[model samples]
Target: MSHLHIPDGVLPVWLWVAGWVATLAAVTVAGRVAERVDVRRRVPLLAVVSALMLVAMSSEIVPIAYHINLTVVGGVLLGPALSIIASFIVEVVLALLGHGGITVLGLNTLIIAGEMVLGWALFRGLVNLAGRSRVRLIAFVATVVTLAVTTTALVGIVAIGGSGATARESGALDPATLRFDNPFSRGVFSLGLFSGGEDHGHAEREQHTVEAVEDEQGPDETGLSVGRFAAVIYTLGPIGWAIEALLTAWLLGYVAQVRPGLIWGGHWQRSGGRMPGDEGTVN
Candidate 1:
């Protein structure tokens, strides 16, 4: 759910470039902070978390319109700093696999990193407020935070892409004038996964017609106006965000109760200066 499928060159250049810069800055800060910490000891664990993210995101449940990327769980376990780096690495690999666009990598990374940081913060705060034994509370807070962050980022992306216009105005963009039909067709193509095979051939033919018209018009003239584009993006992305949050909350909550040691900073361990047998018993 944290992954963005927006293609390159779809969004205005400024918005795309700005997102890239912000993500770079964030990565730099996270890297520096991680360097001072015992990251070497966590390399194997980080690899595992990255692998989990890759697999989780790959298994798409068609009806839900999105996949579960539970890097937030990793964030809660490894802390936000390390999770940021881990998410960045995973996103890069996913992009190479054609799961997302290269130009939008920065924006995608920032969104996921936001989820990681917010989830960790929520986890830490809930553990402190309700006491560590209230495992359900911790999971609930983490899930809520993850949803909120992901939703906010989706809204931000819509706003940035200038898709917030009303339907009439959004439809004003002539499909016949587009440079590439991919940008205009992305929304429908994405939704096609949920629609089943009934209209598949028809949709492809229509998409082809639109692409032909757009090809004649050249690149600059075909995309929707900023307001209209933003509106479309805002309209579609939130549902997936909510589903992911609920799933993450339930899964994490169960894990917290069954294996409390996984709830970072909750169960004191020998390596962190606590006694060996004290593991699993919260402070």
Candidate 2:
């Protein structure tokens, strides 16, 4: 939700540049940790996880830049160190799909990295506090927290970008009353979300209508107010966030039941179930 739904050239150059610098630093640190640990077995899994994340994000849900961000799943399955690297890689690929601006890749990566990192930290702590019976509960709470934090960050970014009153007033989509013809809807459908047959005809109507409105509205405004930003995010965020949270929780619980070592390190080597030593190290 914090990925800056704004298209290219909207954000100030300095902000995006700083984003890239921060991402590069995170990547460098993650690389160093991966190398030092020599979790040789974990190397191959990186490709699999990255691909999964790419597919999940690429499949966008309509109206908002909302998708089932399997961040919790990624953070839990892949350690925080690897999750950071993987998130950066996923953001780079997203650029090719016209997901986010190339210049803002660093900022986007930072937001996603925060999600995974918080998810990982909270997942471990919740498991320790609540015990294994409530695995799903822990993941659910962790995801909610992650989404909350990310949404706040996104609001801050919009405010920092200094969006004007006009843009702020019209920028976000109204959930209670959705106007079919808007950039948000068209932008979402462009990614193959709604296609083919009579249902698509409705989509076309909205898309074309929005384009016409854009023509009538004249040049697009650059900035959006924090109110508008939060409006769109909260309106669209809860559904997807809840969906991802429930799924992440259930899936993690399932994984824990069958192969707990896949999470919290390979502690399964000693026995049948419930991770060996399940103690002394988060990873």
Candidate 3:
């Protein structure tokens, strides 16, 4: 859920640079895992799955900032190793569309990757516990747990990042930019999307582009208190989680019935648009 929209200048160069380093390290780890698993076959599958996640994240409902992440969905289908790369790809693509800071791409990757991994972890266990009898319940619980962990991680990122921000930068820092009270908002996910206050009521924005919210030079230093920021995050987090959990669960249940192999371990196939396994194919 942590797709923080703060433009390039808001974050210190050191911090964003560090983010890139960490992100690259993660990608390296993902690469190692993929090589062991079978890079020749999985790369094509990874691209297709990553593109799907990109579409879901990009399709923002302007009225409410709700966009499907399908982070867990990727984890379930692609496994944690490939999902990290997939999440990073989604973040980079979103930056190209001007939805987020180019400098902070690595950080956003870390946040989203956390979601993908946790969702995979929970679902891997829960799917076993539920067996084949209660697929929906297991999915619902896994998604909710994933959201909770990711959202809480969002707060930690904001708190830490905000603390490292330039305190004396001469710019207006508006906390109201969050717009959490608005009925039609991005909801908890917006915690990941918030930047130096962009007018979000433009519900009809073309899906292909995102207006750059950060200043070309840098973002204004945030003056939002950690206590207040955390308070708002906690307040809005549960609402968004519950809503997304239901949606995610429904999608998982549907997928389970149609392509059981996608959810559980199945023979990996290389065909794009479909994942064929011993159980069945998902197309």
Candidate 4:
């Protein structure tokens, strides 16, 4: 729900520059913190989770104009430090693939990393309060809350970006319903999977769709105000969040049952090195 999908030269220079600086600092800190763990053992898992996130973020669900970000899932599996690193890698790749512009790379990374960190913290804290037995419920609640917070952050970033920080191409939003109209009508549920920006056909179709919407809506006075933009996001966001939360819950529950250490913290063996303050339980 938080993927920017903005093109280059859109956001102001100051905003993107600040985003780059902050992202670099976060990644540096994440690298240093990651050194405390036996990162070698988790390298493969990191790669897997990063790839999954890439796929999820690249594909837009047609109806809701939303994408599933398995960032919370990554956070649960890889923890905060590694998840931050993964977020950077995923955003960089997404930019290269034309999911969002290179200019917004840092900002996008920060948003996704926020989700990972928040989700990890919430899940851990909730587990402590509710107990580890309810892994599914904990993951669901954590995912929902994390997405809500980060989506609000995304809206704030857009508001700060001035008029250029629209969620998608101009006139794409149906102001009355605050939902993006689906240009693709092949199916009720469609996955515009990784069309990349290079798809000439898809690009043409998108242009036509925007023009058509503009003609139908007549003159647009809304002009992408924070209030209207936020309405569109909030209207669609909860649905995506619930779907993602369920997916997170089912996946985390299975992982917790089979390999509890990954979710609970540390390794199954004492030699694997435990995180500070973590209750390392050997399965």
Residue by residue across 1-283, what tens digits does model 1's lDDT show? 5767777766667777998899888889988987665556567666887888898889887765577788667677667777888888888999999988898898889888888878878877777788867765566657656765686676667655744223223345333323222565653432233334233334466577567855776554444465554455456556665666666677677777676566644223316533222365676
Residue 195 of model 1: what lDDT?
32
Which runs in model 4 stand beyond 4 Å of their true positions?
164-223, 267-271, 274-283
Worst 10 residues of 1 by lDDT: 189-198
lDDT of 2 at 243: 80
Better of 3 and 4 by lDDT: 4
TM-score, prediction 1? 0.68
Clashing pairs in 1: 162-226, 162-230, 163-229, 163-230, 163-231, 164-227, 164-230, 164-231, 165-227, 178-222
Best lDDT goes to which candidate? 4
The positional error of residue 214 in candidate 2, measured at the CA in angstroms, is: 21
**Candidate 2: segments with Cα more than 4 A from true spot:** 63-65, 162-223, 267-283
Q: Clashing residue pairs in candidate 4, if any?
A: none
> On a 0 to 1 TM-score scale, where does candidate 2 land against the true structure?
0.72
Residue 172, candidate 2: Cα error in Å is 21
| Model 1 segments more than 4 A misplaced | 164-242, 266-283
User: What's the TM-score of each model vs. the native?
Assistant: 0.68, 0.72, 0.73, 0.73
Clashes of 1: 10
